[model samples]
Target chain A: MAQAPVTTRGRGGRAGTWYLFLVPALLLYSLFVVYPLLTGLSYSVFSWKGTVRDAFVGVDNYVGLFTNEAFRSKLLPALGHNLALFAGTMLVQNTMGLAFALAFSRARRGKRALQIIFATPYLVNPLVIGYLWTLLLSPTFGPANTLLRAIGPDELAKPWLGDPSTALPMVILITTWQWVGFPMLLFSAAIGGIPAEYAEAARVDGASSWRVFWHITLPLLRPAIGTITVLSFIGSMNTFALVYALGGSSGGPAGSTDVLGLLFYRAAFASGDINAVGTASALAVFLFTFIFGTTILLNRILRQGEEAM
Target chain B: MTPRRGAVMVPLMLWGYALVAMIPLFVMVLGSLRPTQDLFNDPIGLPNKLYLSNYTRAWTEASFSTYVLNSVVVVTGAVILGAAVSVLAAYPLGRRKFTGRGFFIGYFISGMTLPGHFGVLPLFYLLDGLNLVDSRLGLMLVYAAGSVPFNVFVLSAFFRQLPGELDEAAALDGAGPFATFRHIMLPLVRPAIATVVVFQFVPLWNDFFYPLVLLRDESKLTIPVGLTHFFGRFQNDWGTLFAGLVMTTLPLVILFGIATRQIVAGLTAGMNR
Candidate 1:
């Protein structure tokens, strides 16, 4: 029941004419993605009153992100938190995921069941994960405090999510916890893909196991390492649902967990200003530039590192 | 001694990680089954008895039934239509070498790296202009479009992997491109398409960003958005919220149980691309 816009203008009877198959998807993509992207860029330059473009404001909204007192305070922390989230993920996830992958790749028995367990948390919603952590860490009634008090001292069993000092780090840890399986899985697959002979040859040379991993296995898994790092960077930059679920839109506990995602949501929707659209669009563009720019930069460095390896 | 240490260490690390991983789920499942009063009283203990009432309360009183229906509709709509479009798009892109072929591949592949937030604000307005704001179809279109770039990238690789001789053989037998694609090609890449469908399904099902921003109607909210609303309304009742969380997550948990292989394969395949 699908039409291909028949025309008798090809060399090979049916298979010769390409781009005909591209007609529908390109049309839909252009209508949806390409168009909105351009218009959104245009919106970043214009002042908007809800839906209508009011005036061509020419980067004032962008300027406001840094100079405006109210916006600057929020934006800077949100940006810092995003970076902190990235660093935390890079350190914790890479170390844990890589360590776990190194172990799991050699694992033979009960691998499938273990795979299911590692894969389960990431399968669920990140927002739901946030809620789970919040529930588990509630100071008054959360099991974390209860268990801590049971094991250690009462003072040590302080509020996890309620205290500003611990909120962002806790959120970052919980976020990393939910996603640690993915990199673990990725690294395991990459490790498995490496031929058996490389390690055998190293061991045949009387190399230590740690040396085998450091010298032979790691260099080969460079591409996978690059992939995981980039993915983690992108994922952390778009940190919204989890943070929102944990700390609410204000990213509470004195905004310790405030992030660019929540900031954009506030600028775009929650601010209740008539001119919110313009500023929000500006934030969207800014987020895009920051995320896209860093991603490109990161790939270049990673690629260089890959080459160096 | 070294071999023994390796054996013990690997199993210990993996099994230990698994136990820690299951704690949230264990607590969630156990927490959901207990009465709210009991949960607060003994936060970490086993429930004295199975309490099915919280599930019923979340299902009916919180209107999660409607939310789940809305989520299913949006997810199914997005995945099905997106897969269809991606299959068609991947055909020419995958098989034939033509001028600007790299450009087309780069264009769609670029969408994978580019964050979705860029177009969201204007996208909302664009949908509004089409009178689709707050509509499930509107949300579905956005999601469906969002899925295309990744699916096309993945599916195209799958399509490319099939031998070219099959296409030539079909052409010589008087089969048109359409028929060859339908009968021969579509079946060969069934695993790949399955992977794409799953990769698309999880994100779309879990997404709350679009629904939160573009949809205003409570009746039409997807599960994630509905979940936030449910939590807000029942802030005091962690039992009901836990129940909601369990109900929201179970389908995905079951999906993982069934398709863990496909998910892992998809991850590796996408990385290779």
Candidate 2:
């Protein structure tokens, strides 16, 4: 912690230069991100239209969010839908991402080509992904139904986005398609980081590939798995575009896909009822707390594992 | 080592999933080539003959050329400004032993956990107060500000890993702090820079929330919002929508193709350390 010799102008000048370097970022961040965030927390306590001055009602928004029938019915179900989406993504996208990563690790000839192909869906805009899938699942012209009809029975080819029961699941599937590759890349890097020795040692003991993966590779890839899981959980919870595009503002077929984000958008902006903006901000606060807490817990568990190792 | 049968199955499973992943892209291209009636009628089938006019029609109808230009300007501005500020802030945080450095680092990184939309309502009013609503410059500032925390975190970590001997050697050569950073440090962190560029660029290019809230003028809308214009109340024009979707997705696909290697390398580099 000894300071280096004063080779530049002087300590004062160096400190001044440092402050100069920091100014642009600090100023912008303070003006946009930090200030707005603080103001949002303050706004959550008040009711106002764009024209009228806000009146603070201190925790009333939070109280209403919990007690009101409309909020309870709408908000609770939307939270469930968001959780379902997260669970679906964990099972399907993360699982397949891990599988692809393991395979890509061993691929020799077309590794680069295969990586590009697998990553293509992730690079597309979410709006496009939503639209493309909407087309593919359109009851009239969508190829998904056509393929289902061709391969299976006609009974299976229902209007995918139209049916209330199937609509949210369909949106989750499309989002999974677009996002699976991100976890694949993360898992590949993680699986690659596991030193070759552990796997080799397991194999030397007459263990099968599955055993090696279960006993050695899985244990070693814990950090990456934890990181991706936490990140993806937060992401799926914050997700808005796909659901908005596929299910619309109401998040319908009877509000099936009305996740927190879409609900916030509608309540705050779409309705033009500025009083509801406080409620929307309350919801945003709830989401931030939920995800942030979960991430911290996951990180702690991972750190504990690292220490135990 | 014996080539286990399970290892063979792993590749097969991966190949199968890879095929599933590519199905949408293939279908998109196919949809772009077929006429509207044909697209609906034979949604699962290949077109009888490819229609090349879909791209042209999509481009003209959606005003995608203007959207693309707007997107390019916004993304480029975000990357350049974001990277410059992040690097400058990160250098001092990484190299200097100043008091409150940890607190500052933690402060910056905390922004990453908070969703940008959490502050959207207030942000709208703030930008409005500054007369920056619907302006390209406003969007650029927002993007850069949002990206700074993560960029600084990543760059600082990369900077910390550099050998101290190199900094001392540069200092011994009469290189001032600026010169040492310019000559010695910058070259060493090329991989980190590449990672930051790709990471920031992709999200900025694909961003929808800021533009949706901030920009009301249809002429100034970015690609994602512009493409959403195809979906109206009564019905969605499926053919034109798919065509527009394909057009918007193509540049990203191409960009990913070219930078795929660097992306993988850069991402792993950050994760590994």
User: In candidate 1, which residue pairs clash?
Assistant: none
Instruction: Estimate the TM-score for candidate 1.
Output: 0.89
Residue-wise C-alpha lDDT for candidate 1, range A196-256, written one tens digit per residue: 9989998999998889988999999899989999989998888889999999999998999
Candidate 2 residue-wise lDDT at A89: 91
lDDT of each: 0.86, 0.79
lDDT of 1 by residue, B128-201 (tens): 88999999999998888888898998899888777667777676687777887899989988898899888788
**A1-309 per-residue lDDT for model 2 (tens digits):** 223643233354556666666778888887889998898888888876764548888988888888978777888888899899989999988998898888787876677777767877877777777777777787776788888988998998888888998997888788878888788888988888889988888778889878988888888888888888788888888888888778777887889889988887777777665567778888778777887788789789878987797
TM-score per candidate, in order?
Answer: 0.89, 0.87
lDDT of 2 by residue, B170-258 (tens): 76688777888888889998888888888778778888888988998878888888777755621445566667777787777787768
Model 1 iRMS: 4.9
